[model samples]
Target: MFKWIQGGISAVTGLAEPEYGESHFHSSTKRLTSKKVNPYTRAVVSAGDFDFQNPSNTNVETATFYINDLETGYCGFAQIIHSNIGITTTAQFTFKLYNNNKDLGFKQIWTSTKLENFEIVDKKNFKADNLTLQWNEDGSLRIKSEVNPESIVDLLFKPSITNGVKFGTDPNTYYGPSIEEQWGSMRHVYHPRCQVEGTVTNLTTGDVIEMTNEKTFGLYVMALQNMKPHHCAKEWRFAWFVNETESLVLMQFETPKSYGNSIVSQAIVTIDDDNETKVIACPCENDLKLLGQYKDEETGWSFAKSVDYTFNGYEIKDNNVDNEVITDDSKAITFELKGELSELIERMDVMNEIPQFVKNIVSGVTATKPFIYQYFSKDLTLSRSDVPESAFRGSAWIEVTYITDEREISE
Candidate 1:
């Protein structure tokens, strides 16, 4: 059943714009086509290819994608949600990305649609019921369930900053006179590790499971600090991903106006004998391969395959990489990552017609090096198994070895 009014509204408005503040928020609506649909109450959904589900709402009857970006010197994130059982209900989606820097904290907000307002959907003209979610990872994640029939109304929300606008770490906010002046670079390269905690409620079974898992990855960035005339001088572009069930995370980033770009990779696994901690460092030099790409309809944020991952003890099949022995046999867990880096500097240069002083920072810099890294299983599996179930509460830490033209890549 659907209806569309003359001033008929749409389910999703458009991608929200990023604004300055302490935090940013974004949201959008989608509908499922299948009748025997998977209940949103049990399943959590997210925009972007990165599927990090909040532990709080596990099983959902109906769900929406919410994102929040908190601004500190670094950044923190939170995902908020709501669900429905029978009647037409509404929920708000929110998330934040922030930097914790005391002097230059920054944030932004982006919302695709608005709430407190109704949109129209006429059954007769409504063409598609199936909501197709796109991802850089090649896998069919369809709605598979055995329960009631459901549909989506108008999905809308707004993105606004929390604490107004603030300069990012720099106090004297303004750009210099020249567009081609050379600015300095800021480096804070490290491996990112995370521990997540939440509760998942099974719609059919009516059971709740608390989830707390840790994932680690590498990170790269080029940063800028303190400007006389120009307030925001630093620009950074990077990539990273987190795999919890398997303890892995990686990233590569460089700020605009840097001497040379940088890449890093790292991993942590359970040790064997006494089962302590073992780390694998990033390779001095490597190559990246781009396998796929996609974009979110609501936020318009895009992601591209930047590298290929391969593990020594693991296997890659149909473009899918996974633990070979752990899944089939009781063999050692080993892994490797391979991938490519897309040239984003040219595109970034045009961002808001960047001021000359800002442009000076990234002058003559070129991205040439590709990063390669590997991880092998020792007693990691055995050690994780030994941890009491009580210790799996989702609080985790990550470490990374950084290497570039300047430093050796080692743990």
Candidate 2:
């Protein structure tokens, strides 16, 4: 009733036309009935199937560079976003540095944000304010930020040996009657495994935090969402873990109830083991199990003490291509995320943490409570059917959202 009223009002005033239909979402429309091991959502997500999509399109997009220092337990991230809200568009950039050790929290003070002069030059370069992030032909990025006098950054992210990945063949998860008439879309690109060699200096003490290839690892994610945040999904769970010899990452996607409450997920496990050193499996089949969940009395949102992920896919020991489905179990594989969820890094309240303009975009979602929980643990274990259980220091970023209760919509 409320959305119908809004649509009727919008129809007359040239307001935002919220897309209305379910046919546009076929990216995960149906799982193949003949997967070798498990029901698969994405068609063929092979290593090197990852390609950079233009965020400058009619969508809200963000590119993030996250770093983890194995030597000093320090982590940092730099993000540039192309924000397209109702009746407006803007570019935003933010940089944050975190430390597991509480004492050196002094250096964490140098944070920066900007709201203008952003440009996405191509798949390789982007600029927001005075910050510039450019990617080389070899998947290396040069990041330089001088937008803030408080912090100075000169960082370079080079992929030592990593595979770039995305979910499906078509890539964009659309929502509407068709592509030409679609009103919403979402996509993601990942280099879940990488290395960082750079320094972030704080002007207060002239102190420097150095990250190198031998002692630090980094993960890169580029994502896009063209609709109001709440219209996309009801909940999301994410995990990224890298140990001495392996890196496991998972992203669980859940569509909103209005869209039939669909679940489609993607995950990858890259190993440098003896038999295979490549991405063992970039699976489109994922199961996220929420464990030890308790309700937050203050917010009424259920928070989980821990979560688990199970993935099944074909092991691309270098033979799988990007176009067809694998039908043989000869190289089928499975991976599991079973361990402590580590330290609670931060509990992010979306409405309170975001800027005012960004808030206006999400304000339309009146019934949703959006919170993100980030955890970092050094003791969680990664279990694979082929190898011994191994523990690794890694980070998990989770989001628990409550949209409107299930409501039937008439076509």
Candidate 3:
């Protein structure tokens, strides 16, 4: 049977209205389905499907592309979000450009209409107005966006490991076991490691920043959430560490107490040596620990700067598992983050970025104070079981939804 946590503390509490329907917000158990290839990908074996449609008020889909160039100390992040809540829908695009001279340029453009312009031609292709995202037949991805006049990003993602990783209980299910499904459904897939190349052009300044493959690393993610954001998770932690020899991506989140205080964590580790690439997938959360948290003065949210985790690596077969564990103590996967809070790249009050109507809807439903903080770190060291110790010089991003903090709510 599909096991789910029983009620403890309701994340919704008095905020939820009866009109939203209790079936959409209650926890229930069901029989676990057998592992099979995702029906959405039965005809085409691309990176799953991008055409996720749900009429619920909390349905949301997003695509994010991030690149970090170690050689020139430049980084770029571009994302698009399509959120449909109740009778209204919103489409937003955002871009951030960090230059070699320590300059950060950011922009966000949105429209409540014109959502029809966003298209998913197939499981591997997507387009939004002037922005075009495509996964090539050879497994590379081309991402181009001109949604903002001030900043235009044209990038390419060439995976070191052509086959990306999928996180779910089985091929038929994409979200795995989490509180997201108990209340609603949230799922994610990622191309964890890639060689990135492209350019970020500033139209107003008529300047162009070239991103070459020399030392440019990237991570691509596609996510879907079918419930109100605040009701699904209370906090989130994400980071990517890339050096000359390896790339590591970590994602962890805490479900609201309504779901038994469960935590979901996943990691992808990629190593490149002598032109050979090895991708390790940690599909299960076993003995995972996130500790040592300090509150950020600016955001007023506690975040962990370190992590201790262990998982059984597996080689996926036929989009399912054969119950085989692929890692041992010597070659097992572990991650550690120790460093000074180097440079704060960006801190965003997410609610402020959305429309007031949507903000009211969120505030009316939950006491969520959502904030996102992005950082650049150069003082940390990363060590793994199979690779030599290396400096964890890269970027880290954190998102927190501070609930029930009167101070934050007042602010």
Single out the weakest 10-residue window by summed lDDT for candidate 3.
1-10
Candidate 2 versus truth, CA RMSD in Å, comes to 4.6
Q: Write the per-residue lDDT of candidate 2 for residues 1-411, one digit (tens) a residue.
A: 967876764433222334443444644324332333322223222333333354333456787888777668777678777676555677766677777676666435436466567766754577766688887767687788877756677888776454465554445677777777776777777776677888888776777777765768777887877676566776777777776667876766677654556665767777666733456677776777878888878656666777677877766645244424565544666777765665665666755756775454433433445677666666566676765663444554433445432232222
> Residue 127 of model 1: what lDDT?
14
lDDT for 402 (candidate 1) = 17
**How close is every model to the real structure, measured as TM-score?**
0.26, 0.82, 0.74
**Deviation from native of the Cα of residue 97 in model 2, angstroms:** 2.2
Best by TM-score: 2
Each model's RMSD to truth, in Å? 22.9, 4.6, 7.1
CA shift of 118, model 1, Å: 36
Candidate 3 lDDT: 0.57
Clashes of each: 84, 0, 2
Best by lDDT: 2
| Model 1 Cα lDDT, one tens digit per residue, 1-411 | 122321121112111111222111100000111221111111111221123211121112112221111111122222222222123433332222222233552322212221332221221011112322222122212111111111121211111101111011111111222223422111121212222233323344443322332221111111112211111212222223322223333322321122122222222221112332222222212233435656524323334434344322221121111121123433333343333332221111121333554343222121111122211111111112223431111111111111122221111
Q: Which sections of candidate 2 miss by over 4 Å?
A: 1-4, 8-24, 28-58, 102-112, 161-163, 273-277, 353-365, 388-411
Overall lDDT per candidate, in order of appearance:
0.22, 0.63, 0.57
User: What digit string (tens of lDDT, one per residue) describes model 3 on residues 1-411?
Assistant: 111111211233223222232233322111111232111111122525333443455577778888778777776677777787655777777777664444454332222223347756664567778888887777787888787767677898887765556553332222224445444566666777788988888778787888875788888877776666655566766767777876767666655554444555666666675786665444344344445778878656765555444443443323233223333322334455445445565666777756787666556445566777666665455554444664445444423335434333221
